[model samples]
Structure formats: C-alpha cells, structure tokens
Target chain A: MPSLPDMATPEAERLAQEAAQPADPHITDVALKPALFDWLCRMGDGALILGHRTSEWCGHGPALEEDIALANTALDLIGHAALWLELAAEVEAQGRTADDLAYLRDAMRFRNPQIVELPNGDIGRTLMREFLYDAWHYEMLLKLRDSSSPRVAEIAAKAGKEVAYQLDRASDLVIRLGDGTEESHARMQAALDHLWPYTGELFTDDAVDEAVAEAGIAPRASELQGPWDATLREVMGEATLTVPDRRADVHLGGKQGRHTEHLGYILAEMQFLQRAYPGAEW
Target chain B: MVTDTLPSTDTIRNWLGEVPDPEIPVISVTDLGIVRDISWQGDTLVVAVTPTYSGCPATAFINMEIEAKLRDKGIEDFRIERRLSPPWTSDWLTPEAREKLRAYGIAPPIDGTAPDGRTAARAARLAGRSNLAVDCPRCGSTDTEKVSQHGSTPCKAAYRCRDCLEPFDYFKCI
Candidate 1:
C-alpha cells in the first residue's frame, strides 16, 4: 500500500526556513553558566542513575516483551543523559566530555533525586517508582521545552515524547496491577507506600533550581506540584490504589549532592570500567 | 567564502544525497530528513544533521557513513555539525521519501498535521497520544493493533494487522 507524500504545510516551511537561519540570537546569547550547568547535571544524573537501575532488568524482566520495553526505556533515558551531560561539559569548559562527567563523578558529586537511586525491589516497586518519576519528568520536560536556552528546549522537545510514552506504559501497569487481583493490588499499594517519601524530594526547590529558573533555563520544581499531583491522583484512582498521605515527612538532599546509600553502590558499579582503566574506549 | 577549488553547495548536497541512511537502506539520509544544512567555512565543508530520535544508537553510525561518503567523493576538511534546535520530526520526511518507506513495507508516518492543520503529530506525542491509527502496509487495513511500542529500531513500532494478520513496523509518529 502506497502512502501519500507528506506535504510541507506553510507553518512547517516557515519553521524550516527559521531553522536555516545562520544563527539564532536567542541561542547565541545563551551560555551554560554555573547555575545552568548545575541544573543540567541534576537532570542528567537523574536520567543516568535511573537508567542504570532500569538496565538491571534487561534480561530479567517478567516476560520477553517487558524485557525489550525496559531496555528501550533505559536506552532512552541514557540518551537523554548524554545530551544533558554533553551540554554540562560544554558549559564547564574544563575539557570534560559526557563520559567524563558520567563516569568520573563520585556518588557524593551526583545530584539525582533520591527516588531514582533506590533499589528496584520488585516489579511492583519498579513500576510504581517509574510511574511517579515519569509523571514528574513528563511535566518538567513540557516546561523545559520552552526554556530560554535553545539547547535545553531542543533536548526537552525530543526527550519529552519518549518520557510521555514511558509514563503511559507505567501508568497502564500501575492501573493493571492496582486493580487486577487482591494480591497484586496489595503489592502495588505496598510499593506505592514505600516509594512515596522519595517523591517529595523531586519538587523541593533549592538554590540551583532558583538560579536556573531565574535564568530561564528551567522551571522551578515547585511549579510542577499541581500537575504531578493531579496525574498521580488520576492514575491511582483508576488503579484503585489509595493516594498516600501528603503530610508524611518528605525526603530531601539528593539535589544538594547528598544521596542515599544506594547511590554509592550504583556509582561504584557504573564507573568501574572508567575508574579501572581510565580513558578506556569501546 | 567561495573558492575555485571547492564544489558548490548544490554539488555537495547532491553528492550527500547519494548517501543512504544506514538503518533504512531504501531511503537516503536526505530522505530521512536528517541532513539539515550544508555550508562552507573557509575551506571546510560543514554538514548539519539531527538524529531522528535523541537516543537512537544509529546516530554515530550515520555520521560515520556520511563522513565516509564525503571522503569517497574526494572531499576533505569536512565536519559534521550535530544540530539539536529544530529537533527532527517525522513531518520533515519528504513526500517522495514517505512513498519509498511505504514501498519498503514500513508504514510512513501519518500526516502530522491533523484536520485543524495546526496540531502536528509531534505535538500529539508531547500530549502523550502518540498511538495514532496506522494502516497496514501489506493489506492496507486500518484495523491494526500495536504489538509493541518498540520495534527493531528506535524510530519504529511493531504492529499487527487485524485483517491480514501480518506483523509490520510502523514508522512511529515521532
């Protein structure tokens, strides 16, 4: 079956023309200063660490299809990490490459949220954590798509689609397991409770977030609260899972480079190749 | 700056067009809408490219292929500039290219511009509604179900036609 050729709309043509311009003034003036670089590192680290954790399931997923899905999701996250870290390196201007930033940094120097660094306890826990994180990530990327830094905006634009798909998949699983059977529902609920405290850290704004927000590089983490809450509530409702109490004490400090105990082990494993053989190339 | 020894931009573009996409062999890089811009700086030729998917593993290979093709054409002092702004969209796939993809048994993307003509498919993706109905390439049936959101490559998704019961890849809306 032959398909019709996609005709370029006038708007698309205009966008194409705009892209062809020698240089965008908005892009030329946007430099990855210290604050922006820090913000980018936080974003990149979250993806990298979570991607590493998810990759642990590559061959062990419950089913063949799930194995492929998890691997693909891991690849997407790592890909986003590469973009963010590459930009961070460019801003640092210390001759650091994406790999350098990814592999050379110790656990204490990493800035991913506490939630992503935790162990993937079970399929229930894993999907619950992913669902929560993906929701925030999807909302965050939507705002980032309009960042003053054209590079961030572009990366967000490309990565947002992948995150959306992940969110959909995770949400589906959450609903399925939450409403499936008594044991399954109980397991998912328990996972939700276990992962809930870590989510508060995702929205706690700090100096780095403030600076980036001021510089138009990213939105304030606090700004994502409403959307994140609404999404969580809606998905949980469909899944027949109870929403955890919000007043519970929140976990914090991952953004400030202090991570949970799990992060150190993750770093040790992930950076082993580079640390053992510096400058190793595939 | 024009130099007597250098080929024209048109000549360079045509030569680059001959380089096929490493993954989708039936289509050229240009057909895939990856070769965004070609320019000259001093004596060096700059080819700007955007990856179809940010995490696409084929990006490095694609760049290598382009470099090899240019070198084979006896062009030296060239650099491949990776452009992120105006990130690649399936909408950029030219009409001719879409037809070629369909002919190759991979369904091309739907017209990203819906009836309102403003909402491009990428926007739909950002809104988390990417599973747009895709017709089967073999039986031309709209009744198809997505078997998996992923396929052999990052750019495509797996689907099976309800009518034909044939599994195929849908060049995903992204």
Candidate 2:
C-alpha cells in the first residue's frame, strides 16, 4: 500500500468526498463487488498499456493534427486507467492510490492485450488499431449503460461518448486512407493482415470472465465480438480494405495476463518511478 | 435551537445549479452531464460528478470548484465523488449550452444528429445552392477548409479559410 499524505488536510477530505458519492442507486448498487474490482483492474491495465504506446507518437505523427489527436486520446486512456485503478484499489480496501497501481505493477502482472502493447506500426496501422479498439470500446460502453450495475453503467455511459468520438475519427481516417491512393490502400490492407491475428485475443475468455460474468457486473468478452466484427468489417470495407481471414491456431491469453514481450518494456517505463522511489509523491 | 429536518437533496441540487463550469461559464456542471447526483448521507452532502474525459486535467479543478461552491453555501460536510466509468459525452451538451459554445468562438459539438445542423441551416438562410459555408469567424467568409482534426486543445479542431487564409478553431462534437 502506498502512503498518502496526512489525511487531515483539506485536500484529503475533498478526495474522500469525491470518492464517496454514489450515482443512481440502481446502477451504483450492482457495480460494487469483488468481481467488478478485478474487471476494472484488467480494464485499467489495458488502457494504461495502450496509453503508453500511443504516447510514443507524440512528436512523430505524420501530421500536426494527428499528433495532437493521438496525444489527446493517450491522455484520455491514461485518465480512464486512473479512474478504474482507483476503483480497483477501493475494492481491495488496500488504500492504494491510482498512481500506486498504475506505476507499481510489474510487467508479468499486467493484463493488457498484446495488441495494445504492440508499437504503432504506421499511420494506417495506427488508425486501424484505433478503429478496431474504438469500435469495440464504444459498442461495449453503449451496452454497458443499461447494465444491471449502475456504477458500471454510469461509467460506460460517460465513456461511450468518448469512444463514439474515437470511432468517428477512426472512421474518417479509415475512409481517407483506404480511398485516398493506391499506396495508402495497399498499406492499409497490409496493416489489416498484420493486425488480424491479434484481434482474436480481444474476445477470448477464461477464468476471469467466468468470475465477472457470474457477478453480473461485466458482460462476456465473446458477447461483444459480433458487433465488434460487424463494425470493423464496415470500416475496413469503406477503407477499401478486406478484413483479413481469421487466423486460426493463434494463442490467446491477454485476459490471463500472458502478454507479448513488448509489455515488459512498457511496464518498465510506466513503473520505473514507483519501483525506484517507493512511495514517492510529487 | 429547535431541530428541523435538513434540506432535501433536491434543495442542495437546486442550489448547485448556480455553479457553472469554469471553462464554458455559460454551462453548469449539471447541464454538462458531469454531475451524476446529489444526496445526503446523514449530515454530509455527497455530490457525484464524472469528468468529460479521463485525465481531463480539468477534473481536479472542477472537483475543487464543487467543494468551494458548496462550502460557500454553508454546506461543509459535503462530499464529491468523481466517477469515470461511464465517461462524459457530447450528447449531454444542453441545447442552450450548445449555442453558448458556438458564440464563444468554438463551433458547438455536432449532436451526431446527422452532420448538417448548422451547415444546412446556415445554407437555407443564405442565397447559394451550396451549403458548405462556415461563415468565417474573423471575416465572415463562407469559403473554408478544415485544416486539422485537432486544435489548441483536445475538445477543438482546426479550420482554415480559403478566402482570407485565416485559421480558427472549431469546437468539435466529441
């Protein structure tokens, strides 16, 4: 557990207050549970890894606008991770700060998918990844709004809007790239071919899903796949790219915390501060 | 002093309606869909708010503003919960608030209600058959090109004028 500053300060009181208020009774009630905690941690880890990956594009984007957009989205994902990590900390009753969970966790312990951990290959590849993730994330949030768990629903409702924006941007980029020129179209198709194998991992389920689903707090990952595929297909078609045929015999274990080699590096950069200066605060 | 029932949560909510968002002063946090709910847990008042985006940077300030505003009203035991699960959306932009955003030199977020809310309306109110005129903020020229999908901040995008060659920000609908 990370040691926070003295709890008597005005700021601490404010933070406590902010964390204590519950939303709609119906939604908030169902969201509070042990299962939700684990789900949030997994979800937060995913966002944190992806945020770090996207942040790498800060000054290297093909265009100024794209640079800002990717940076802003990275910031948004980081913010989302902080929120979910806070919830996860609260679940354990461990008093861990969002910074603690985000910066302290080691690589092997993280549950973010290998796809997010992968480097942004190219502008077209980056856009395709964003399109696929945003499509799933946006659609998930939409469904989550009506979830039995109000807290989850509430967060989903709010996140749905952001993901919707991301989806639109991805859609625009896909169309622009797929229809822009022959080279661009060919590159996008190649990007799809490269990214296709990893897409299977997104929906693969295991023990964690079993736990969360039984709790009624999180919908199954498989449940989100159909819509995810449909959306991806439509966008890829518009981009003049064909969806790469499903690559069978591919291993899937992101949900189980078995990640790609890149995750280690991403975690090292993210966790360096916490491990170096244990309990250090800005 | 004779004891009386504390003001209902609704009363506190009504009082909070006076607190507007710091950036877009024309809109209140309530109208922005950030404020989730207000309630009383014993003598303590709890206010729930969600940030427009995760790591919005404005959230810390918004949380402080809520505390100060409520404290100003003499309600000290109040709490503010910043929930981030269901993220904030542009759909929450109230009709009046949307107009205010536009007037503030930021193109109001498109309601996702088909792309032609202002472009078509402004066209119908114009003399030409084409409806793409964006009415330049500086020179009032209809000729413009969206130069970038990003601007000075995450919430806005950039547009350039073909007529006057001036660049301005469009508050995108996110």
Candidate 3:
C-alpha cells in the first residue's frame, strides 16, 4: 500500500540460490525465525523511539552547537532504525516493508525497551539518559559485530562507528556539566538517580533474547551488562556523579509489548501522518 | 555488430563520473566513491551505491541522479542497489576529489584518520583523542580549531581559521 516494490513474485532464480547455499545452522532453524524477527524489531524500535525523542530537541537545545549535535544524533539513529527494520522485514519473508513496520505498529506492538520511550525531561536529564543508553548501546554493537548472521554483523559494524562518536560526546558533556556549577552538578545527579531504574530494562533478557543468543544472531542482553558497567564506572567517576545502586527493573515490559503510557503519546505524534492518510508520501 | 551496442562498465562509470554530489556541486559522486560497483545482472545494469552518512538526505537524490543518468543513456533496465556492508568511509574519497574539496574552502578528511574498523581495535580514537589540527582552507593555517563536531551537513564539521578567523567546513573523517 505504501508503494513498495512488488515482492509477491517468488522468482525461481532467487529460490534456487537460497536452496543452493548452505545455511547458517543457527539461523536456518525455521522455528527461530520468529524470535529473530522479534529481536531485530527490538533493535530497530529502540533506535526509532529514542531517535524521535532526540529529534524533539532540534530547535530547542540550550545552544546552537548543542542543537546541531542533537539533530545529527537523531538523524543517525533514525537511519540505523531503517537498516535494522529493513533486515527485519527481510528475515520475516513477508510482504511488509520497513516503513510498514515503523509506521503501522501500535504502542503495544513495539519491542523497544522502556528506557528509550520515557519522556525527555530537561537538558541535564536528557543528556544523562543519553550517556547511560549510549554506554549499553555501544557495548551491544561491539559484540554484535561478531553475529553469526553476516547481515547483522554488517549493520552492527556500521552503526558502531557512529555510536562510538555519540558515546564519546555524551560522556564528555556529562563530565563537564556534572562537574560544572554546583547547580548543574546537582541537576545532573538528580537525572542519573531518576533514570537509573529504567536502565535495567536494557539488559533484561527474555525468550526472544534466548533464541537470538542461541542462534548467534546477537549476544544475550545480560552479557552486555559487564561492559556497560565498566564504561559507566569510568564515565560516572569522571563526571563526579554517583550512579544509583543497580536494582531489578520495576519500569519494565516494553520489550514484551507492555510499555509506559509515554509510548502511546509518542506513537500518536510519530505515527500521525501514516495513520491520518494511509500510504501518504511527501 | 548489433550485440556490441551494450556499453562497457567503464563507459557507464564515466557517465556517472559526470554526476555531481547534490551537497557539494563541485565534486562528482564517482569521485566521492559512493558509486561502489557497476555490473550486469542478467540483462539489467546494476549500480551499487553507498551512503556517506546513514541519515544523509542526499541519498534519495543521489539515487535519482543515478537513475536519470542511466535513463539518459537509454538504459531502462538498470537497477540501483543500496550497498551497506564495508560501510562508506571518508578514506574512500579520491585524491583529486580531496584536492577539489580543499580548493572549495572545505578541508578534506584527514588522511588515514577516519577511525579504523571495529571498536576494540580503535581505543586510541575512542578515548577522546582529537585529530591534532585541521588546516584552514582559506589561510592554510594549521592553527585552526574545531567549532563543532557537526557542521551544516552531516559529513562536514564546523571549524574556523585561527589566523583569518573565518569559519569553514571540514569534511569529517568517517
């Protein structure tokens, strides 16, 4: 309906190529395809939702430089989302396109972890949330470069380059702001403490994670925690910020399609055009 | 004689060499190395293009230009594929293209500093190391400082000449 390339014709040439190549045993298991699709959706959804939130700062950043930087980060995240979702659609072997998955899904159908969907409160809070998420995201991408699925590896490698820059910038700003004025420091600290509860959701693993881990498509989410912790310890140490004690996530379930009300509001604004006029294109 | 009407890959490549980047009109897309591979897929001409930045708005325009170029050559059966693996790097910019960028008042990406492959092996850059200096394209001053990591375009960084104090764009490495 969105003017997608016709994929209904199952060409014998492609079928023959698929039949001829020896499949990766981990991913070729037909039962695991659904799990893989879910896993890919989680990756793409996180990027998209967070990207939308970051873009909200487009004209509103505290300064010109900050505004431009935030916009660039948003663009990169949205770009990464497109790649991940396109691969997800391919893995599903359905007629759905990446645009369909991104624009048509309801709040309950999204697989992004809850941390990404929470509202961006203030500049300090936004930066604090960004720092925490960047650490985990970078670690996840680093490990994903070795994914058994070469396509996954390829995307990870590409996105990892960009995330490295994002993580570095976020860490630098967090340190500067957290150690700046007493007022700025207090606000940053408050942001870290407030956002800590949601951080756990990023590493919370489930049946989908188990499937992807077993299939070598991705590392178990928990495995990224150690690296995430090390990066956090280093960054927070320099920022003079105290990270809240690690605890089980009470604000969870986004990955499982149970999200905070914030996500519904976000989807309302994000999916408005697609919903208002189906198949609409600029 | 009739079968020889098909153009060679090199000829198609030359045709593409004439298409300038939408953002930087002075430089051709082929010189930027976004045009990755040209081959014949069955009877159709296949052109593989890569994006400089993941979210670059120019990609759609680039694709259209490539399609138009092919159409101009009477090749209607061509397919343009977006190739993502191996990733596009600033390192791929041609020597002549880099010179052109410099002359256009935008510093070319620092040679051999586009952040190497993978993170584990790239600790030095990942550790907040700066690229030392970006010479001002206007006054050719090595005393320039970075204004910001991002510039007007995603691929460029804002900078200013320390000597002339004039702002300029630096094509970012990576």
Instruction: List per-model TM-scores for chain B.
Output: 0.85, 0.72, 0.88
Candidate 1 residue-wise lDDT at A134: 92
Quality of model 3 by C-alpha lDDT: 0.81
Off by over 4 Å in 2: A1-10, A17-36, A246-251, B1-47, B68-75, B83-103, B112-136, B139-144, B162-164
Model 3 misplacement above 4 A: A1-29, A246-248, B1-3, B115-131
lDDT of each: 0.79, 0.68, 0.81
Model 2 over residues A105-188: C-alpha lDDT tens digits? 676667777778887888888888887777767766666777666666666665566566566667777767887899999988
**What CAPRI class is candidate 1?**
incorrect
User: Residue by residue across B62-168, what tens digits does model 3's lDDT show?
Assistant: 87787778888788776676676788888899999999999999999886665432242224335554444788888888988776777888888888887999999
Against the true structure, what is each candidate's TM-score? 0.86, 0.80, 0.90
By summed lDDT, the worst window of 10 consecutive residues in model 3 chain B runs over B116-125
True contacts kept of 2: 0.44
True-structure RMSD, every candidate: 7.5, 5.7, 4.2
Distance from true position, residue A10, model 2, in Å?
4.6
Q: Mind giving the per-residue lDDT tens digits that candidate 3 earns over A42-63?
A: 9999999999999999999898
